[model samples]
Target: MKEEDIRELELRAILEASNDNIVIADGKGKVLRVSPNCYSIYGMKTEELVGKTADELEKMDVWSPSVTKRVLQDKKEVQVMQHTLTGRSVMATALPVFDEQGEMIRVISFSHDLTELRQIKEDYEELRAKMEYYQSEIQELRDKDQHMDGIVLKSKELSNVWQLIHRVAPSDATVVFLGESGVGKNVFARAIHDKSNRSKEAFIEVNCGAIPETLFESEMFGYEKGAFTGANKEGKPGLIELANKGTLFLDEVGELPLNLQAKLLKVIQEKKVTRIGGTQTKQIDFRIIASTNRDLQEMVREGKFREDLFYRLNVVPITILPLRERKDDLLQLCEFFLDMFNEKYKTDKVLHAATINEMLDYSWPGNVRELENLMERLVITTENRVIYPSALPFHTKESQSEVFELETEELPEQADNLQEALRDVEIRWLKRAYRQYKTTYEMADYLGISQSSVVRKLQKYGINS
Candidate 1:
């Protein structure tokens, strides 16, 4: 063959061997030829595409808004992203081939498949979002520095509780906390775990009342793959297993079902747990810290709670008084929560003197949690530099009336000497307040006196808790 024909043959072989789709068309946008790779790349046979115009391909629904037609109309190179009917993404580079007269003679195009790259990019973005979500949740769980700082301790009652915590936290003994709901039983559990030798390990907290009865066993003991319908295919570890070498805080333990209570007592005694629907038993080493607002002894008497489980769990009991019972901590707690809400909502609102007195005088049935929520509300809704009693959702007038009724009850019969008569009346009133309230701090708050004064009078009156 002649040298020009050989060169043409070599060029045709190179284009056919290329991985990208190569197409040659006349200046009128009629397809003259396409490389064999067009079938693999664009899902269209090269022979079928040959002699087909851009308008013909559009009518056949093979390609939308043909790049070759764009280059033909403008007589210039055009690069565009195209999606074929077969759901393949391609980058189409169409160039006009001009002769010496500066007029377009033919068009050549290359299509680079970008489907895999797009899929990879989408997968990366999805993974990044999942990582961020998990990271935030992990930070919320493990950030003890934030949690420890939030607890308020400003009274001798709480100071004594802290001393007890220090005494028992060094040991791996099971501790049971008794308190009203939202009184920070979980906080005390966390403090014990943080002070223990297993502080480096996970402190898994589970609410016995929160888990469903049907899922309680699976959640506590885990399950093997195909253990039951809808079970995880890869199997899962339970909260007990997760708490190995750490602390397992079971809040609202009094709410545990009788059957599960037996199972839990067994796990505590045996130090081993068997997964649901599996024969294998795993040995575990974890500390137990249980809390409940309910009286487990009363439940045991009524046969609602297992007596064996109660004795096993109640090795050492710590009673956390309600906020009304520790009124001295109220203002400090209010200030702490105010600071937290100020930082959270970016506000500088201060409490008015009347608002502080209203907070002090009112009986907080919801305890510290209520106060925290109130501070957040004031921070977000207060329109002035200071938060006033008018901003309170509850009526301070009604609360003041309740306080007055509690204090203004009729005094006992009088004595002979005027001073002696006053002292006798005061003692009777103090004794009545003590009987009415659950704690000395609460009596002091109701009588508008200090907790220390209440203690001193109780001591003088020979009163016992």
Candidate 2:
């Protein structure tokens, strides 16, 4: 072969082997030649691109702000970031090749694909933003948990209750809390008092059921010195008087005798109390917060409770739902009490997954108090660091058996093959976990699987997480 022909073939081989897209254009920006990989970068065949001008290709949206055009116009090297019709991002640079007479001869451009790098940068930024958002949410939840006064307010029902409490706490509207025993009525009553303007003053809790009938009058309304035997030498203030400028929580108000109920009603209505065997009536200023588990309306209809007194105390009634109905808070409550007792007793006990599932299934009849008590018992009695299903009390599993039966009864009809039956069970569990937990991390923890596996299985089954 001739030496010139050999040199031309070598240059062609170099252009073909180059990784970047290389294009050579004339001084007027007319395309002269393009490397084979130019098609991949611009989404056009080499033959279609060879005869096209830079301005024509730019109009076709092959690549915007052509580096070749810039190099040709400026007669110098130019670099630009270009977006191509192929949906590829590129960093393109063009250098003008000048003849010996200082006249432009050609423009040689090189383009490096940046699509994958740009995508990676975007994904990193999105993940960073999500992390910040999740961290803020977690911190907010921790703050709420610390200040809730041993109350787990995770459920929507409890959130509404908190809203109602805030609305009524600012006013002294004679609030009353109605719920089953151990539903944290006393805690809520104290919460109301603390949220009020009189929070700086005394909060006297009077259990009407615990006071004896004979002593109820003196206990509620103080006795003067020497009024009766065993009376204090100095005049004593009554419970109502002691609560002046503060809150008086009357726990189990329904247990008060009908005669005493009349007196209590007078004290609430008049905001004044007269000491026993005393002639002068004393003025009082206080807020009344009452709670009762019994049906005072039924008592009034049965002639056991005074009707007028019932109306006076039933002004702003707040009913707290039982723990069974607010299952969303059960896991948090359990973990809270467990951590509390663990610190109190200096133990390190963790609940196993099975034990947690069993606890979730059981219906807590005794409410939060029962759950607290059970956690304390388990923390104290469980021998190992991890408390498993066998550590659960017999009554808990017995109660859960009915729920388990109901859940199992609704299972899909028996499949002809074992594989189908197993798949049906898997789908049922996935749906149940999805409904019970708020996040995939929680679902994975409850279902005893990796988070990635949970996501993949959910996608495979067409389950929307």
Candidate 3:
């Protein structure tokens, strides 16, 4: 065979074996040759396309916007995306071959199928959109968690209270929170205020009980300059006036004197406030949230609280359950407080399981406030990193007595001598008493011994309070 014929055969074999569709076109845009793979991309055999021009093939809907035609017109390399009649996507590139005279001689085009690539890209875009949407939803949940302000809604009672808060937060109706002294009434008041439309404005808090009866009027209602001897010279805005376009949190409203109850009611009814000694009335737009630990109805019956004022403030009443009733939240609350104070005080304290069990048994009379304080105290004062039951201030005698019984039950097996066993029993009881009582006087009273004897015994036993 001739050398030129062998090279021609090799070139044809290379073109037929290529994964891409190869096409050769004349400078005038006439197709001269096509690779065997042309059928897969353009859905046409090589022989059917060999004699056709790019314009004719485009007109036949084989592939739109031909790169070969673009290369012929521009006399340079060109690339384009083409859609085939066979429902395939392809990326085609064409380059012109020039002679020594710098005139274009031929255009060689190569096309790669892009149908699967396009589908994969589309799938990636869809997944990215979904991931972004989920991230935004998670961020929204985190924002809501920040607004919770350490409140644990594990119990059904608190969950119901939260539902009520959600139902009433959007409105401007007066909300009164009723609960025991440490049941987090103020915390609920703040939650509602934060969820309301006026969250961006000032939240003026007034402890009606903390303010004296003599100065309650002046403090609640602002006074003009020189209105009284001790009044601010530039005049002062009272709690009510300061709460304009915001929330007025009247904490312990039941302590308000009878004279001021009518006045507060008038302000709530009219949404206006006047200075203590001034006649000019200022129009106020504010939301009222009152919290109290007292029974206002009983006070009204006893002629202490005005019925009309009580009725006015009781538009939306929300009751918060004490901590003891919400026992499910105890462990979560303990962990929350531990994390908070540990971060605050730079400690790594953890609650022992026994301590948690003891906490579950105790009745928290002081409610969440007491628990919070106790956690803080334990975190600061505990010598070890783990907080145990012996570190807690409040423990029932029944629980401590169980420890005594367990210790005595093992005395016979553990003790060697009778005197040593009796001494061991005394030491254990004294230590138990020390753990149960805060002072030696209380321990002495419980043991029916003198205070001096209790101190001496505790000293001998090396027990420290």
Candidate lDDT scores, in order, read 0.85, 0.87, 0.87
Over 221-334, each residue of candidate 1 has an lDDT whose tens digit, in order, gives: 999999999999999999999999999999999999999998999999999999988999999999999999999999999999999999999899999999988887897788
Winner of 1 and 3 under lDDT:
3
Q: Give the per-residue lDDT of model 2 (tens digit) for 1-465.
A: 999999989878978999999999998889988899888889998899998899999999999989998887787899999999898999999999889998898999999999999999999999999999999999888657544788777788887888888899989899989998888999999998988899999999999999999999899899999989999989788999899999999999999888888888989999888899899988899999999999988999999999998889899999998888888788879888998999999999998665777787788888899999999999999888988666667445554453233233454676878788888888877876776678899989978999999999899898883
Q: Give the Cα-based TM-score of candidate 2 against the true structure.
A: 0.65
Which candidate leads the pack in TM-score? 2
Clashing pairs in 2: none
lDDT of 3 by residue, 1-465 (tens): 999999999979989899998999988888898888888888899889988999999999999988998987888899999999898999999999999999888999999999999999999999999999999999778545633788877778888898899899999999999999888888888888888899999999999999998888888888999998988998888888899999999999999989888888999999999998799999999999999999999999999999999998999999888888889878778888898999999999997554776898889999999999999999999999877667788765666555334322467557889998998878876876776678889788756799999998888878873
Which pairs clash (backbone N, Cα, C closer than 3 Å) in model 1?
Answer: none
Per the 3 Å backbone cut-off, how many clashing residue pairs does candidate 2 have?
Answer: 0
lDDT of 1 at 206: 98
Q: What is residue 169's positional error in candidate 2, in angstroms? A: 0.8
Per-model clash counts, in order, read 0, 0, 0
TM-score for all predictions? Answer: 0.55, 0.65, 0.58
